[model samples]
Target: MKNKSLYLYSFNQRKGIFLLLLVMIFTQAIYFFWSSNTTPQKDKENHQWLALQSHVDSLKQVKEEFKPTIYPFNPNFISDVKGYRLGMSVEELDRLFAFRKQNKYVNSAKEFQSVTGVSDSLLAVISPYFKFPDWVNQPQKEYVKFENKISDVKPKTKIDINLATQEDLIKVYGIGPALSERILKQREVLGGFASMEQLAFVWGLNPDVIENVNKSFAVVSTSGIKKIKINDLSIKELSKFPYFNYTIAKEIVTYRSMKGDIQNIEDLTKINGFPVEKLKFIALYLEF
Candidate 1:
């Protein structure tokens, strides 16, 4: 009878135990539902972050593509892409290539134009940025300055050869009193010198003396000399001219007798050993 009473007493708390069990079951259900959602929520956040990151990267790439920047570069060393960027055509690039193949470089903007034949408008746009090496620019600058200064400087006073006095002629280093008189006599015989080159024909005036004469004297006033007809002159008469020797005069007379007339200096080139080099010089005093 005591054991039955104890069992009945234990059964009296069964409602409270069932309610506590229900509470535990509800907490476990809540915990499991939270756990199931946590990973997918984190994954969703990660996917959004990745999409944002990709969009930012694409924006950066577009910015980089559109950005315009140019740096000074040597035209001599330009590659195809660089040249294209500078607006050079294929033919212009090819010209630069061919010029470079000869181991030559474009030293100046002008030289670059001459080599590549770049249009003036395009050259105007790109030329300011063309950075040649220091050596390239320096020498050209110095030479140009030298030429400009030379041109800018006043010419020293000079006396015309035809009008120069004997005292003036003697001022040249090699010309003595006798040489000065000889030059004056020759000037008188010729009426006046047409060119300083005629000084070479002055008897006993060697090349050294001629060089000295050129320093102080110049044929500034061109005086016309009488031109002789090649057809009319005998070999003897032609040989008497300062330029023509006996053999050359004979050859000329023979060529004229056979060929009718030497139309120009070109016609004289056909004669054997006609001093073909001096044809132009000789042509100065000859009429056909």
Candidate 2:
């Protein structure tokens, strides 16, 4: 009886151990399945936050890329969208102007290039905006010869009578010292020659001098407009006429605006420092 009782206690201990191991395995498996399904939603939210963070980082990079660049004479910091942007290096401006003569219409880039006077090394920098304008640009034509080629030779070298002083007038073939003095005296009395044919008016200016000079010379045409509209002519062209500069040209326009149309040539006298006799000498070149 003592031996059977000892065997029964040992058997009970073994069974209790086996039952504890089975429960532990079952609990672990349940916990693993619960975590796998539940953790995915939290991971998805974390992934979305990471993507938003990437976009936010890109915003800072863009800001740095477009910082305002400075250039001489250009007060506004506005960047060029099509040609070049502000804040670009010296190389950028160089490329924009490189083909300027071939492509004249890229206004801002052309202006910048003119201002900066870029060199060859910097061309690659601004080449992105060096697009040629369609309106003004023609496809470069090859120099092909056709049978009826017109010569580009000048018609002839003409004496510029409009530019000649009294000394220069004497250089003409038939104008002697006496004739030149007579011409100058007549110019003083009559104010000026109204036409090239008026060379006959000089006391001793022979027909031969008039004929030779006419072949190489032309008088300024007066047949156009009897009155001048100041705003029509460019500043350089305006300055070519007697006693006019940028300030005077602008003043003429302002005066016309304030007073209305200039009806006669005498109206030019209204502007300050306008020499009436000098104007009469130059009137043939101007028109309304």
Candidate 3:
């Protein structure tokens, strides 16, 4: 009986140990299954992160698309900083500045490139944004209207180039605001236009444009001219004239001081660099 009791106890202990192991494995499996299914909070956080990532990516795309907008601007007045931003090199900017320092302007894309020495590639990129003065793009009137009781035929009125305003000049084909301003500036410097041929001297005025200007305008009166008293004027005063540069002015003053007084326009021919060809034009602005 004692031996049988001992055997039963040993068998019970082994069975208990096996049951304990089975229970432990079942609990571990339950924990693993529960952990595998994500919590609502974790799931929500993951969704939020994905949404944030997508939004950031969209913002990056928009930023790329909206970057650096270029606008229409005048290339003539481009500063060093502006030129640099436009891909112009230091040498190119210096060339442009040098041209401008002489009171010259770049009126066209070709002239701009010629002055700046920029590459064709850069010119192609920036030329489209070059906004010239407004008058250049304006369409001129092809015909003039007349109100006459007797005849229906309307004759085009001739404008005086010397008296014409910027608006008036733009009415002529090929004369834009910039060229019109240039014409006025040239006329101011010379005192007045003495002849229709003087139109050829206007900067950036092409042959065809000059032809159109000639057709539309005339020098009707010499009364508006401002003449200089050559004999009494100082070298500085003489140099102020468009025709007489500093060197020529100094020579004329020197000649006057030595020769007493200038008798006539013919006497100026004796001076060096007198611009003999332009004597007639220069004569209009000088007095004895």
- The lDDT leader among the candidates is 3
* Candidate 2 per-residue C-alpha lDDT over 101-182 given as tens digits, one digit per residue, 9 for 90 to 100: 3433233544555555554444345534344333123344366876656677567766555445667766656565676677
lDDT values of the candidates? Answer: 0.80, 0.58, 0.85
The residue ranges of model 3 lying beyond 4 angstroms of the native Cα positions read 1-66, 74-128, 133-157, 176-191, 200-206, 245-247, 263-266
Which of the two, 1 or 2, has more TM-score? 1
Inter-residue clash pairs, candidate 2: 69-87
lDDT of 1 by residue, 167-285 (tens): 99977766777778988887776567767887776765767668868877887775556677887899998887766779988998899888788898788788777776556656777
Off by over 4 Å in 2: 1-23, 35-79, 85-122, 125-217, 220-288
Model 3: per-residue Cα lDDT over 1-288, one tens digit each: 976775666777979988999999999999887877667668989999999999999999999888476899988899989998889999999999999898777778998998888999999999999987654556555777865777776678898777889998987787777888999998887667998777777777867788888788889877878999999889998898887889999999889888878898889899888899888878878898
lDDT for residue 258 in candidate 1, whole number 0-100:
89
- Against the true structure, candidate 1 has what lDDT? 0.80
Worst 10 residues of 3 by lDDT: 133-142
Number of the top-ranking candidate, with TM-score as the measure: 3
Task: Report the lDDT of model 2 for residue 216.
Answer: 66
TM-score of each: 0.42, 0.28, 0.51
The predicted structure with the larger TM-score, 1 or 3, is: 3
What's the lDDT for candidate 3?
0.85
